[model samples]
Target: MNDVMWKRSLALFAVALLLVLGGCGQLTNSSSTASTGTTSNRKVQTTGNYSTTGYNSVVTEGHYKTSAARGVAADYANNALDVKGMETGLMQLSQDVFSPNKYTFQEGQYISAANVKNWLGRKSKSNATGLNPEANGSTDPDKRVPEYLGTMVEQDYMTGSGSKLSLGGISIALGMNAVDYYQKEQYGATFQTKVNKDKQLQEGKTMAQEIVDRLRAKNNVGNVPIFVTIYSLAEQDSLVSGSFIAKATATGKTIDKWDSVDQQSGVLPTVNNQKPINSADATAFNNFKTQVQNFFPNLSGVTASVHYLDGALTQMTVNIQTQFYGQTEIMSFTNYVASVANKLLPGNAPIQIIVSSVNTTQALITRNSGEKEFTTNVLQNY
Candidate 1:
């Protein structure tokens, strides 16, 4: 047989296998329903829930979370920082920074401001100066202390020799009211804008120094290395772009030296060196879509896109459009599409399959050996 005819036969064989595996419920359901004579634009929505049955524990829903954080980091590093990106970046960074070392903290081993004081054998006196000790007469007992987002003792594999060094790190979310005010003021015709920006940065530096000092007082941290990260929030409580604002390190002996937000170094490492999808990959993806359409004639259209990181495919998304009668048909079609794509796709990267109709949409995500299945309603016109 010619190549075209051979591909057709293979497509038909795959569809027959799908129909058999889909069972009587799907066939009966599909046969009973007729198309409503109305044509409406389909809106696509996606929701996901993960299952970690047999895959490596490291690759989980966290991968998507990290991906999002990386996107935010890229925005900041490239000077495209915006309110939404800033907020998202900080929130995701908070989750990403502590996740890898979660298991290290035992039941009561987590770090806290109060506990750190006790660990240093210091008295439990509240800071009368509140978050900013430099502001005179601002000693309101109700003033908020540095909100500790998270803290953990991480092992420094890169810096330690022979035995790994226990590195203690603290994450804090700080208010950006001063910075926001300065940003708005800096736009004015007055020369104070530059002054205000400088003052705000100085205040940020001071706050960071105070935090480090409190954590290191009287050798509280002993010989372990302590790292502190301050994430600043704008007036609306959203994260400020390029607002990794302050980072300080102390060795429990000398004073902590704080640095202004280093635009180049503050970005999370995972986001660096990402590779864009190439022409060759695009061709391969197009071929895969053609094969899928041949295997599933009911599909009205099929679209595919690939996501890459450091010259390797990290994710592939396939959207299948069709007219479906009910949930049974949707499930059957989704399963069939996922199975076919899983076989055709290369590498162990995650695959996202989105199946949509006029009024409903479903998403099936597979990563490594695990799978996440969820569905959503299409409420708006596309």
Candidate 2:
């Protein structure tokens, strides 16, 4: 692929990656039938891959479009960010002398470079000027059982030493339709506009379970290390959607944000001074305990209190404390993860942590309110 075509190919990859866990409300009821009509091919799956026939998917049913991977066309491969990719990306992102080789694309029915380049989507929006990936049923697809993940996500935290693919750089901006592929196929824009919600949710659940399993294998494999993970996505009562991968840390410091009506005062920070918190962070803290057992001659179980300051700014504050322990290199660990995260995926994306015998107290201001400010205080270890 030449620079232009190769650029577009990369752009298409970006389009395929901005996937959210949008789909049917819940599969709890019998009346909620699948919006996707997978009967056409009889042997196709929806993962926004090459098989998708729907708007953003390949599977089609009724008037609503589903997954492009499940759709009729077949040029795209499965999510490169799949478990396979995540593992590889993490490994790659861990290098001191970062010498990343050109990553090869997963095998899909090969489409010509020209086709990918000039490919404008099926239809077009009038009076608009841009390029988009066309729906030219050009490539054939791979038919195989996907390599799945295990049941624990926290265990899959990309820690230790390895390099990984950073998903949100130019890769995300273009492939996800931010730069426009051909015409109406600015695919990223079409997700919410075209893809089915039920399918996305189902995919999310499957992916979630797989992520959990892998995480457990990675972190817990060697004597149950304290594994930390940040669980993101929308959750309320029994209904939850969307999913995310976050840094695993031993610092269980989180600020809960509630209310959507106002940003100025609806969100606030909370400090957890109690033991046993979110599972991911708790595990991370435990692992830290093992690592630091030899230090802080006088260490006792302490807690980081997280409380929200119900006010105009939506923030979370954590009060770090310890019952028994010594000086911790908190900044060093945080920096290391931040560095790895930057190398793998570049952006302002937040990283979560689970802490042990140290009190890491601070207010995380989430809202982009004007120019940001910072303040720090030195406290006694005792």
TM-scores, all models, native as reference: 0.35, 0.18
Q: Tell me the lDDT of model 1 at 165.
A: 21
Which 10-residue span in candidate 1 carries the lowest summed lDDT? Answer: 50-59
Deviation in Å, model 1, residue 243 alpha carbon: 15
What's model 1's TM-score? 0.35
> Candidate 1 lDDT (Cα, whole model)?
0.37
Per-candidate total of colliding backbone pairs: 0, 106
Q: Specify the highest-TM-score model's number.
A: 1
